[model samples]
Structures are given as structure tokens and as C-alpha cells.
Target: MDVRISVIIPIYNVERYIRECLQSVARQSFSAYEVLMVDDGSTDQSGRIAQEYADRYSRFRLIHKENGGLSSARNAGLEQAKGMYVCFVDADDYITEDYLCRLYEKAEETNADMVIADYREVEEQGNIIVKELGQPPRQGCMDRRQLLQALTSVGECHYATTVVVAWNKLIRREIMCRHFFPEGRLHEDEYVIMPLLLECGHVEWIEEVVYLYRQRQGSIMQSAETAMRHLEVLQTYQNRIALCRQLQEPELLQAFKRAYFWNIEIWYYLMRTRYGVESSRLYGVFSRRMWGALLRYHHVFGRRKTMEYVIFAISPEYYLNQYFK
Candidate 1:
């Protein structure tokens, strides 16, 4: 029996959470799907648990390899996937039993290349907060251009980062195959998602909550060191800019700017925590470069609302406190 969807899970040291994650998939109402668990060299008992699940269920398959980071694990799963559609689920996260069924129904109805569903954020202590970033359109069909415009204009729809979690949506396998994620990057999703969205002609939005994203304290986004690694995030934005230019999609330019500004604020916060006032010196250099980019893409902002330009105009430290603190 051919599977309609391949659920790819990249497992690392998630022994504590792996059981719940796998069980959620196992109990899915959508039966015609295979769970592909790629163990990325876990030092914990996660691998053993994965193997146990694989042995119990024919649809579950396990692949063990040396840890090459998240991107490598996802790529390995992508290469081995055999389904019409593919959706990624982080090993530590769990989905509603009807997740695949709901996403698949939306995709089939709209004939959409992608279908995105809402998800809940679960804190370490098991507190759950449902996040609905924006209201979905009533009835059917979302125009790709209009969606992009709304997202960019409101600074909401920008892809990249975990905001566009690979797992919360179902994507056509063919489309995913056309664009492979860049490995060897700490923030691979930021580098990959925009291109995927650009290539997708139609996207379906569903209001139902399908996945639960666990927010652990020690996650990369929460760490001081990872937050200080702002250069990598900036590089992702640069790549997006180059790609947008090459494709001649000028409308996306504002989205890129919004993302860059957001990164600047985050970096400033990290610097404040790590180096205090001394951090301003390093930020001074970054501010100059950002100013240049803002000027080059002046059309993205108006004269009156160019607060970023004004703040960054003075000095990095000035903008740092103004935007971040």
C-alpha cells in the first residue's frame, strides 16, 4: 500500500519526549502515512525507543547515523521519503491525532502545493498556549501574491526561522524535491523556507491546531551563546535578498528588511546580556552596515516612518537601546 504522506522526525537526545511524539503519530486518524524517524546520533535512550517503535509497527522506520546537525537529519529523511506529500515533525514535539487528516483534506480541496495549520506552544511545565498569529481567510483559496503582501505589509507572513516550522504544514513532495535545504548552517530553515514559498503556486490555510511545539528552557533560541550568533541569522537574510533580486520579486524586499530589523533587535538583547555596555562597540559596526542596506532599499520605508534609519543613523548603541531594550 502506497503512503499518501511521509512524516519525517529528526531524533536527537529526546528520550524523555520521543515516546509522546511517536505515540501521537501512531494514533493518528489518518492511517495512510509512514513515520520516518532519523536518529541523528543520540547519546541518550532515544535511539532505543525509536527502534522499539519501528519493531512494533510496520509503517515506522528508523535510520541511525552520526550527528550532522538538524539539517543533515532532515535531508537524510527527505532522500529516503516515499510519499506523495512530506511533513517534518521535530522529535520533541507532538501533533494532534487528526493532524495529517486535516492537513491532507485541506490540500486536496484546494489542490494547494502547501497547507499550513495552527499549532500550540507547550511550556516545559506542560502549560499550553495556543498561538494564532493571524486569522485565516473564510472559505477557500488564498492568492499567493495577496498572502505575501499581507504578510510583508503587516510584518507577519515572513518565512524563515521556526515561525515557519517545517512540521506544522504538509508540503507536496515534488515541490520539496525541487528545493533542498542547505546543510552545515545553524539556521537552515531561514535559508530554505522563502524559496519554497516562492516556488509554491497555491497555499491553503487552516484554522485548526494540529501540532504542539514544546518550548524547552535549553533550546537554541533561548541560549545566550546561540542568540549571540547573530551573524548566521544575518547571512540568511542576505541569501534571501540575493534570491529575491535574482527572481525579480521586488515586493519581498520589505519582508527581508523586517526580518533583518528583527534580528538586529535580538542581537542587541543578546549583547546586552552578555557584554553589557561594552557590546555597543561591536554593534556600532553592524549598525553602519544595516544603515547602508536600508539606504540601498529606501523604497521599503517612507521618509516619516524611517525610524530605523534615524536610530541606526546615530550609532549602534543608540539603536540597540531604542529597538532592543
Candidate 2:
């Protein structure tokens, strides 16, 4: 049978988790798929573990490169992928047995450029924290307008933002190749996923919990040293806002403002609690941007949140205290 899907696993120093992750992919019920294990110069035994799988499985290919970053590794996999559809799976996370089968079937059924599967976030010890994660509010095949609406709607706990993540979607190889992940950037998913979705003429959402995302403490998203880098999200959202304006999408523009504001609000609290003096300096810069966006799109903020952000602009400490106290 011809290769139908390519599973790209970007490996770093995830020796502790690599075996389990690879095993999950190897056991997928779907048979017509190839696995590309891109080892980004791992210092641990991750490369060795991946090589063993490659040796054992004829379809598994191991490619090694000097340590770049997550984006670099994924791009490397993309360079060598032989399948029509591509699915990204992080080295530290595993998937359910039917993950590929379900996503592939959905894409075929809907003739979609992308198919998004729901996931579960779990602790390292195997306890699930969030279930049915990343389900779009709407189900079945969605057009570009419907998909954008679901993605831009930042209200009600923001259902589709988690779907923006790379690992949970099966994308047509050509669509994914249109916009590669931005190398050397944190939150790189923010840079590419939305743009890809916007370009897709057809997209589909399935409710199955296929991917299991591990919420580990020392990972890039959780580490204290890299936490400050999340400020990059502000710039990412700004780019999205510009795109909305260019597309003449007032609904998207307004929704992106609320989404942008929500992120800045989060980063402000994180910085004040963790970085102290540096937080104040950054907050001054962030506050100006926040106020500017709010002025243009304040209709999306509503009365209560607008008042709260006003307090945040004047006295961050006072606004933060409302949460702590």
C-alpha cells in the first residue's frame, strides 16, 4: 500500500519519554503510514532509542541534525516526509491507538485540507487534567469562514485556541508546506497554525480524544527561565490582527483583540509575580499596546473586563491583588 500519512516526531533529550511515545505511534491501528524520527542532536539516549525503532521497523526513518530547536527539527522532518498527509507528534507525548485512523478517515470523508482531533492533557504520573481538549464549538466539515469564526471566537473559555497547536491536527502535506514553523521562536505554533487554517478551504473537527499531551514541569512552556519568552505571544497576535485588517474581517479583528488582551493580561501577572523589577519595565511597554488595542476594539471587551483592564493600566498591583486577595 502507498504511504498515506507521515508521523513526524521531533526528538530532543527526551530519553525518559521517547520509548513510550514511539511505541504509541508504532501501535497505531492505521497501517499505511511512515514515521520520521528527527533527532535534534540529543545528548541523552533518545537518538539511540530512535535508531533501534528505525532498525526494527522498515518504515521508520531516523534523521540526525545539529541541535537547532523544535521548529528546526520539525522542518527537517518535513523535508524528508514521503506521505500525502502529515501529523506532528512531540517526542514526549503519546497518542491513542486509533489516533491516525480516525484523523485520516475524517480528512478523506470531508475532503478537508486539515482535520483536527481532540486531545487530553495529563500529568506526568498519568492523571488526566483536561479531557476532550481542543474541540471546536462546531462539529463536522467547516468552510474557511466557519473555521475562522470558530478560531477567532475567544469568548467562553476559548475552545479553539488549543486546537491551534501543531500536534493535534492532520494537515494536507501541501498546506503544511505552505507555511513552515518559524525557527528560533518560542510559541512557534502561534506563527503558523492560524495562517494555515485561514488558507484551508475545508477543515473538519472530530471529538475523539486521540493525542495525550503531557504537562511536565521542566518543559519549555513550564520552565521559569523561558516563561518570560511568552511575551512573544503579544507580537504573534499583533500579526494576526494585521492579517484580519488586511482581509477586512471585522469579526476576526474584534475577536483577535480580546484574545490579544487576554494574553497580555496573563503575561503581566506572570511577570510581576516572577520577574519583579523587570516586570514593571515590560509592563509599561505592554500597557501602552494594550490601551491602544482596547481603544480601537473596546466593544469586544465588555463592561466588566474593560473596567478591570482600566485598573490594570493605572495600578497593576491593585488589579493583581484582586486575584491574590
lDDT of 1 by residue, 1-325 (tens): 6799999999999998999999999999998999899999999999999999999999999999899989889989999999899999998889998999998998988899998876777986657964555544544565656444442332223232123557787999999987777777775766767778888898887766678888887564344444445457567666666766666666566676665656555555556654343554566557765676667665666775477656765676666666543
lDDT of 2: 0.81
Candidate 2 residue pairs in backbone clash: none
Error of 2 at 288 (Å): 3.5
By lDDT, who's the top model here? Answer: 2
* TM-scores of all predicted structures: 0.85, 0.88
Write the residue-wise lDDT of candidate 2 on 35-123 in tens digits: 99999999999999999999999889999999999999999999888889999999889999999999999899889899988777788
lDDT of 1 at 242: 73
- What is the lDDT for 280 in model 1? 44
For model 2 the TM-score comes to 0.88
lDDT of each: 0.75, 0.81
